[model samples]
Target: MHLFSLTCTDFAAALHQGWGKGMFHAAAIYRHVFKQGNPDLAQVPELAQAGILTQELQSAFNVSSPAIAAMAVQEGVTKIVFSLAGGLRVEAVWIPMPRRTTLCLSSQAGCRMGCAFCRTGALGLLRNLAAEEIVGQVYAVRHGLGRAIDNIVFMGMGEPLDNFDNVAQAIRVLSDQRGLDIPHSHMTISTAGLTDGIRRLGELGWPGLNLAVSLNAADDELRSQLMPVNAIHPLAQLKQALQDYPLRKKGVFFIEYVLLKGVNDSRGHAARLACFLEGLPVRVNVIGCNPGPDCLFESPGEEHCRLFCAWLAGEGLFVRMRSSRGQDINAACGQLGGPAH
Candidate 1:
């Protein structure tokens, strides 16, 4: 593993004691590797002059490639399939907005949370990506685009919380001031209702980090049917976890509700959802299901999505409807699964 694979603190600890260069060198190296995506460490003047960048460090630590095997773009939403070490493939989506460009990254090769609507879940969990692999996705996309990315969401191919340790390190790497320097508030981790993960995040005390829970169904029975993870950590337990979550006073967590036509989009379901999230500080993001060839679900009509948002708002819940961006290229939510060639 190279220095690129390690966290900032871990990289600092690995420096030679005799060099006495300290964190100044580590920060400079990180800036070159992460912020600039410098492929060759010897190109960096600070590392080169110190004589510490020896053949040993070169052999032990190497820069990870984003390994973009394939790419598809539609209406400015670009999805790139990244090949990891060992032939495992993951995805990252780049969405360019007027204000900020956002990259949705995957923490695992595939997903274990078998949400009925998601194509990635159908593959099962392949393996957890290393912290460097996670960082490599950002480096690859940004390097390819020749642009800066302002936001990141772990909502591409896996449940981020399931790969917590690696994901956490990646977050630190991305937000490090001498590195990518993305604000904590700009990075969001979306999970498939993992209460343990939620509790663990709370314990970490990173209050500014945003958490989005996929609560596709309001009722326990319906939710369990839609998302199998609900059976292990049901709605009640999830609610308790959110209740105990130490959110910042101004922070509002996201509630992602994927609307499956006639399944979880009924007016009654909306009311039940309102009751379920009664006193929580949340903003419900209503996503119309992005249909895939193998999936049985379908998205509700535009009017129905509007009504769902209206109904949630009627119950005094803050709600917004987000349309699927890249359906033609299979880059939309629930449609990110295929052989990574």
Candidate 2:
């Protein structure tokens, strides 16, 4: 048995004791309670295990419980929304594909970035989720899904760079070999082109960690209209920052282009994009725009999206028409902001 210092990590772990937190490590936690009473228990369950456990702690020493604890895994989709200690709600989505299950985790609650088209930033920034709050998303997902999620993407709710420290700590926790043991190679952190923040990420020396810039526009003027942060951290500086973005031993970063109709989906925009991406070995994940209350943004028609992608691909760029997932549940990219409607 090990005792962790009451560090920020420990603080986050302590908060995870209750609340909608703790996923697989809930077993490790159950293991802790077991060690207190029995001093040794089955440390871990094998990979092929399934089902659930309801640890109804005695009333005399009660901890915490949600009104309901629903546990089931289907279609390899084991998703759990962890309501944190302060009405801060973020989630981790585990989608089991034929070969792997990826976890989509949130870093903040309401985003402050105010990216006009994104739903998450609609409320304009609650507070930065703690490192624990950020990491707890994964922990709770592990508990709910009852399996090791293969991939992690920080494309959930908040603007991670704003809550920079906590997000960084949570990344450390996620990649830590001690608990979750998620390899850095399989994890990704996407930012809305925060240049200084990207520079810091490079300075941190996260080997094999993937960096994604949400560059939905090709020029600064249009980009500022979309991502206000661009007004402060211009794309020119962002490009210089990327130039310094210590690419991990031959790692390829990504530019996430959310294709908006009549916005950044034109031949001129594609050319600007190709030029913007000059002298960089990178890939672009072209995502069709998702609808929001601010319906001014339109997803490019299928033909247009394909044509733009073809043009960029012809320019010798690595491009992927990223598959849109969970739209039926309103759980697609740039979704997952408010209460389920």
- Reference-based TM-score of each model: 0.96, 0.79
Per-residue CA lDDT of candidate 2, range 1-341, in tens? 12211232443354367434344544444434322222122323421242223322222122222111232244445445556565566655567777777878777778888887888867788777767566555654554334667888888887777778888877776665545667888888899988878888888988688988899897999999999989999889988988888897677879999998988898898889999999877899998988865556878877888999998998888999886666544466886664443
- Evaluated against the true structure, the overall lDDT of model 2 is 0.69
TM-score of 1: 0.96
Tell me the whole-model lDDT of each prediction, alpha carbons only: 0.86, 0.69
**Candidate 1: tens digits of C-alpha lDDT, residues 95-212:** 8888999999988888999999999999999999888888888888887557569999999999999999989988888888777788889999999989999999888889989999
RMSD of 1: 1.6
lDDT score of residue 340 within candidate 1: 29
lDDT of 2 at 50: 27
Residue runs of model 2 more than 4 Å from their true location after superposition: 1-79
Regions of model 1 farther than 4 Å from truth? 17-20, 339-341
The 10 consecutive residues of candidate 1 with the worst lDDT sum are 13-22
TM-score, structure 2 vs. true: 0.79
Which predicted model would earn the best TM-score? 1
